[model samples]
Target: MRIRSLTARVLILATLWSALALVTIAVAISALYRQGVERGFNNLLRAQLYNVVNSVSIGDSDSLTGSPALGDLRFSQPATGWYWLVEPLGNYATAPLASASLGVANLAVPDVEATPFDQNYERYYEMTDDVANHIRVAETEVVLDDQGRAARFRVSGNLQVVEDEIAFFTSRLYAALAVVGIGGLIVNGLAILYGLKPLDRARRALERIRRGEAERIEGDFPSEVQPLANEINALIDSNRRIVERARMQVGNLAHSLKTPIAVLLNEARTLEKNQAEVIATQAEAMQAQVSSYLNRARIAAQRDSVLARTEAQPVMERLARVMRKLNADILFELDVAPDLTFAMEQQDVEEVVGNLLENASRFARTKVVTKAVMTARDDEPTDGRRGWIEVVVEDDGPGLAPDQIGEALKRGRRLDESKPGTGLGLSIVKEISGEYQGSFGLSRAGIGGLRAQLILPAVTKDTA
Candidate 1:
């Protein structure tokens, strides 16, 4: 699996190092076990050699003799890989006396003049004999009080027994180490996941802030990520202050500029007929332009503020009631989800919905319908900040041509001068939706008139 999280990275690095350490310890233990087995095997052979040396005696003719039986039955069996011998050194007038296991074959003792004995008065060697069995031999130079001469006493035991013991120990060791390794890795993985859970909570908190469901990242976090949350909260507050300052400035400027234009229009009434008409027309046009742009500036300034959601269903139902009162001759239909909400101020929703419903009422011959739905983005998962609110309004009057729909959205562009409107209603809706990173479009309705579709960001419980 790909390691994408900090937990996975820590688990992988810790597991690799721990596995190395376990292997090192296992190897050291195996080496010590083998050494212990060898030391014990050699001690047994030395004891047997000392027993044989003590059994020898000197005859009246100054000859050596010993035929004592060892306690082990293997020592009495021929070619059984256990043997002992006591023999005179340098022509002492006596032949060698050996265990029955030696039979007629001589023990393969290495030349000892070139080899020195250890502090225990014994020398040991491992060699293979003509019988094809590997064995350990211990030899000692003995001086008997009953005899005037010295002799060599040697004893042997098979190395195959010690090797079998080591093989058994190694199998058990491998099984034990394997169990420890697997168990350790599982424990380490769980520890890593538990240690990093705070980071996961922080990530979810950030998503809630982006969706505008919350104003700041909440709850306590680990020290490593706490500073990041604080910084993000500071930035959000700073941006809100800046937007508030810009809105105040725009409001003041509109008041200051509109007064002079109002005075000019009033003074135009006292001039000549043609000059009065021109000044009055120009002043009205200026007033329309100023109002349109200033409203757009105010909406833009407040678009990024983290605030409470505005419910769409209440707004739609309220507008439907008012529109019905104004256009008593037309039937108004309303369909909206009660929980549907927009991630913007309530005033913004009222402005956009009111304009669309008013335009529908003006043109519809007999019927108008408004619908608001909470929808999920097709390209995003249905969680957190992936939701949208869509409000659609339709009428049954004469609809616009496909080409005329584009022109209707432009400011001050009216298709029919016969219609009683400034041609700024749809333009205002488009500009407000754009400020919230939303969409607005016109299409032919099923009722034969125009359809205004507005899609904006939505707030959901998961985001909160």
Candidate 2:
């Protein structure tokens, strides 16, 4: 689909993509964060369990006491969420366990520590039999070897407090993510909208340019895009000047052809009967060819007429004004019903309509109506997606038959043999149309009169 509003489309897509990326990153971090917190708490709690077990001691006579109590490994007072446990050759282990699931069930506890008052321990976790709940276990052994005695010590601690701390931190993380995600999206959205303000100005400038209210874009815009607008404005000004110069050259070129045409006519007038017939025939043919060349040259020059906006209305209006002054008694009216212009050169348009308009003005009942339209030009194939301009000049003067229509478009053929015209006009229109990738033909109009129509490819600023 084509995006109609560039600014809005860009802003919307950008914001959406950014929000999605933020959410993806946040989810990944949350998962990793929970795992890290759980692992950290588990390590610290297992170490405390190992130390507490080593502090409990038992005698050969089943007497229970420690030479020195374990320090800081277990709570001083009873705690609601956690507690310590010890069992050394005792019938009942006071801890509520689902089973007696010791971690290394059959391994003998070693008495390797040389210091009697120092604590050295290894950490482990297990699920005891009675409650079948996870518990951290640790142990130590002692013997009354000096007095023919033996002893053992074992201790353990509950890990539930450490687990709860990790859970609390994880819960807070969820709330923070929600607040940050929403806040970040809002901040980013405002930044994007403000950044695209220059694009809005550029759009309005283009609209004004189309309406002819402004000649070039000149607005306070962002630095990044200002250069593009400036370049486009420069190019428009350069093209308009080139078109104006080409028109002047065309006028000079056309006037130069008239002198030679006049000389040929005068030369034919002084010839004898046999010689006059041959010379007049050759002269008329030569004059037609010359007129045709000048007309094409003029069309080429006007290709970018007022920067490819060669509306027939304005050009026809000028033609009508010129005809009135040329012959005050003749009645000439340009009957262009729909006044939309053919996307062609001013001179090519003027020549096609002007020549036929002149013909009707010379031969009509003082009535000439020039009709034109804009459609897909004939030369543009049906499969082509090109917009074209078609301009038709018609007259109620004597019409032509099917055979005469083809002859009328021939390079050197003239409809009325004795009519005053350098038969070159229509053919010139044909050549110019072809040069610009268009078509030219002759047919009958809706008014049941002679119609000359030229179908031309729309001339753009670059092509023109």
**Highest TM-score model number:** 1
Compose the digit string of candidate 1's lDDT tens values, residues 1-464: 87787776888798888889888988998899999999998888877887787788776677777776569999898887898888877657577788888888888667766566888788989888668889888999877764457888889998998999998998899789889888888888887787778878887887777566577889998898789889988987887787779778888988899899989998999999999989987787788778778877877777756563687777778888988899899999999988887888787788888989888888899999888888755644334464688888999999799999999999878787877777788998998888877888999999899999998888776665
TM-score computed on alpha carbons, candidate 1: 0.79
Q: Which stretches of candidate 2 lie over 4 Å from their true place?
A: 1-32, 39-62, 65-83, 89-120, 126-216, 237-288, 301-306, 317-342, 359-398, 456-464
The alpha-carbon lDDT assigned to residue 413 of candidate 1 equals 84
Winner by lDDT: 1
lDDT per prediction? Answer: 0.83, 0.59
lDDT for 284 (candidate 1): 79
lDDT over C-alpha atoms for residue 65 of model 2 = 44
Instruction: Pull out the clashing pairs in model 1.
Output: none
Residue 299, candidate 1: Cα error in Å is: 5.3
